[model samples]
Target: MRLEAVGRRYRARGPWVLRGIDLDVPEGALLRVEGGNGSGKSTLLRLLAGIDVPTTGRITGRPRTAYVPERFAATLPFDAAGYLVHMGRVHGLCGRQAAARTEEWLERFGITGFAGTALDRLSKGTAQKVAVAQALLAEPELLVLDEAWAGLDTAARALLDEAVTERVAAGGTAVYVDHDPRRLAEAVPRRHRVAAGRLTDGPGGADEMARVVIEAEGTGEPPAALPPHSWTAGPAAGAPGLLRIRVPADRADAALRALLDADPPWHIRAVRSTGGTSPSGAVR
Candidate 1:
């Protein structure tokens, strides 16, 4: 899917929430959208999900899409299971298939007990699970999550993570926004920041390329041929043998694969963004 100079606003003369945006949402891409509050991140997502249209410019080649909005309306007059089954059907699943998927998701989210319970009667977290399930049941080609992890328990949050990984691995596209910077920080390759009604590539300014920090512990030497433009820090105090490796965000997966595929794999401790740090001693 592609957006060409897309712009959006509530009214014709109202200030633009977003403008001068051009983006290419490739198949199988995992993109992250970031911004401050009232910065049009949600607006851009709604546009991608077809929940809202651009007031100016054009969007073309959108695929089959599903979206979990920031605020899910749990007041729908249907039981949790019934609602999911209906959503599945709307996404082109047959009756039996829809029912089966509904059961599977409810079980996965540990909400099977509430399958027959009315949506309006469920707790906030439970309702959020139902909202997430409705989107994942049909495996839409494009999935948009707007803070869908909020209100979910740790187990359910992990389940959503696995589901998204599966979706992208199966050649689908997923876009999301979350307050937690560490949420899927290791997997997402493309990140765009929305600010002042405009979109900028990467997590920050053009000169400040995003970087991934990998903390690992290894007995022997680090893996051969670590990704280029990467650096390693000597072990820190109180943590002997702890290797802090930093690489450009785009090469993070490659760096990880090399480490994991070594003769004796390195034990990864943590992975996070550098924010904006440029240490010396680049790996050859």
Candidate 2:
């Protein structure tokens, strides 16, 4: 899907929550949205999912889409399986196929035991599993997840991760918003941020570009556990045991994790992100 100069607001003349959002979300692209709270990140996701329309500018090329919000209303009247089956039909699935797919996803998310349980009785984690499962039932061409991992357990979170990987591998477009910068850090997804009423591309530079400055104090060189290419560091000029490392933002989390996990853990003084700036959230 494509958005050109898009903008939105609640009242006809209320403050615009998002503006000038020009983005091209093609098939097979996994994009991550970031920013502080009330930054209009959720508004952008809603627009992309067709839950709301842009009051200004235009959006086009939307495809068969599915969305899982941060919170799912688990107080519905139907049981887990029945609700999924109903949603499946809404997504153009026939009864038998929908039922089969519901079973498949329920079991995949490790929520099959609760499949027959009423939605209102399921636990938060189980309800989250159901939310994710419902969105995947149709194998949608576009999947939007807005903090869908908030209440999931580790295993179920991993299942959702795998589900997203599979969806993108099948040429679908997935856009998500999450508070954790490292939610899918390993994927090295296209990054975008919502801030100050504008949507802008996240940090980016050449592979050799250093986006994170890691200052630490360690006894020796980096352990063999860390890949050589992940970072480059040297002892602080005159300060013994002090090391300064520069790493790419995409690998910063893993790099930091590895550093802290070493035998004699390195004491991290500070880790600061260093990169380009987005002016007024224009897509560049």
Candidate 3:
């Protein structure tokens, strides 16, 4: 997929979220979008997914791309399996195939119990898993995810990483939006920052990237285990209640689990990265 000078504005009076953005994602490559909120990250994903039309420039790609937004789109009363079945049907999958895939993904994400639970009743992480499962069911040529890993636990996050890897290995492409550089460093090898209607490569010079983030679950403490290689610790921005532990790509999972299992309130939230090496002092 290739995007050139892509721009989008919902209203004439409002400022454009994306302006003059140019990007090229080769087949089977993982591309990550990074930026603060309202920085056009979601807008870009929407444009790429063809959910919203752009007011300026053009995007050239397959139209059947699978898009997973930051929020759940299914009705509140629907079960995870039901929602997946509906989505799969829309994507031309047979009833039996949809059911099989739904069951497989739900179990893989460690949410088998959620198969029958209403979307509204499921926890935030579980709902997110359903959303991801639906996207995967389509077997899209291009997978575009917006905050795809937000609110997920460590195990769920690992499942997502593996899913992306599998899809790419099948010659599919992915475009993800995230804010956690550490996760991106581990999952992706390339990074781009969105700002003022523009997109530019940021951090790491690689073509693929990976990143992850672990957050607190109300009253819980952050994880203590750090990623392998070089790691650094410091206060998280605008989050006095937590600390940011940056880890290298090699030991990210171990460091993350150790921290979460330390019996503190920490929970793995999201991961993003440029698939780069973490700084030294990452592990302790």
Candidate 4:
């Protein structure tokens, strides 16, 4: 998908929140966007997700997308499961399919115990899980996560990390905005920023490593099939017995396969792009 000279503003002559924003979000791309408060980062994401339209110029080639806004109201009338099932049907799934996926995602996010609760009554973390689950229900071609992990618990956050990797591995695009610099410090993703109502290139942070971080918890030696420089393992953060594997992006597929196909399956926790410059403007 591509954007050409896109611009957006509130009124006929109001200050533009975004202008001359040209972007190329290719298939299978993992992109991270960074910017300061009020720098139009959210606006750019909104445009990309089709929540809003450009006031001037053109945007084309948009793909099937799913977006998780930074803040989602939990006061909706429907209960958690009902809302997800309704949204699933809206996204074209049959009632049975929707119910099954809803139950599956709730389980994945550790929220099945609360699936029947009213949305407004659930904890903030549970609400966030619902939001994320709704977005992932359809396996959209384009995934837009705007601070989607803010209220998640440790396991749920790790689940989201895994979800993004699976999407990219399947030749889908996933764009995300997060305050934490280390959110995906292992997946060498393309980085950009919003500044002065425009998307520009500048220094965000250190973008030297082109590696993917794979997490698994088990006892095993690094696979011999992987290039010497393509993989390394260590204890993953926040979880004992979990191993974090770092590998060159080009070799991630093979490395992941080798690890998963080992004699004893290495339970994969998360995989993400790491080492990026997070600043107002991104630089090569």
Winning model by lDDT? 1
lDDT-better candidate, 1 vs 2: 1
Q: Which runs of model 2 end up more than 4 angstroms from their true locations?
A: 204-284
What TM value does model 4 have? 0.75
Write one digit per residue (lDDT tens) for candidate 4, span 115-149.
88999999888999999999998888899999999
C-alpha lDDT score of every prediction, in listed order: 0.82, 0.77, 0.68, 0.78
Indicate which candidate wins on TM-score: 4
lDDT of candidate 2 over 1-284, digit per residue (tens)? 89999999899879989988898886656788888999998899999999999989999999999999878998899999999999899889999999999999998887889989999999999888888888999989999999999999989888788777656544567899877777766555678878898977786412322245566778777866553333334422236776555444555666677778987899988766543332111111
Worst 10 residues of 3 by lDDT: 229-238
lDDT for 50 in candidate 2 is 95
Q: Output candidate 2 Cα RMSD.
A: 12.5
For model 4, the stretches where C-alpha displacement exceeds 4 angstroms are 202-284
Order candidates by lDDT, high to low: 1, 4, 2, 3
Q: TM-score for model 1? A: 0.74
Clashes of each: 0, 0, 46, 14
The stretch of ten residues in a row with the least summed lDDT in candidate 4 is 275-284
* Residue range 1-284, candidate 3, lDDT tens digits: 67888788889988877888878776655677888877888888888888898798888865468888988855656787898888898888999998988888888888888788888788787889889888997678888988888988888887777677656534467888765666545534467888887888887534223333333332344343443322222331224444443333455566666756776445545443323344223332
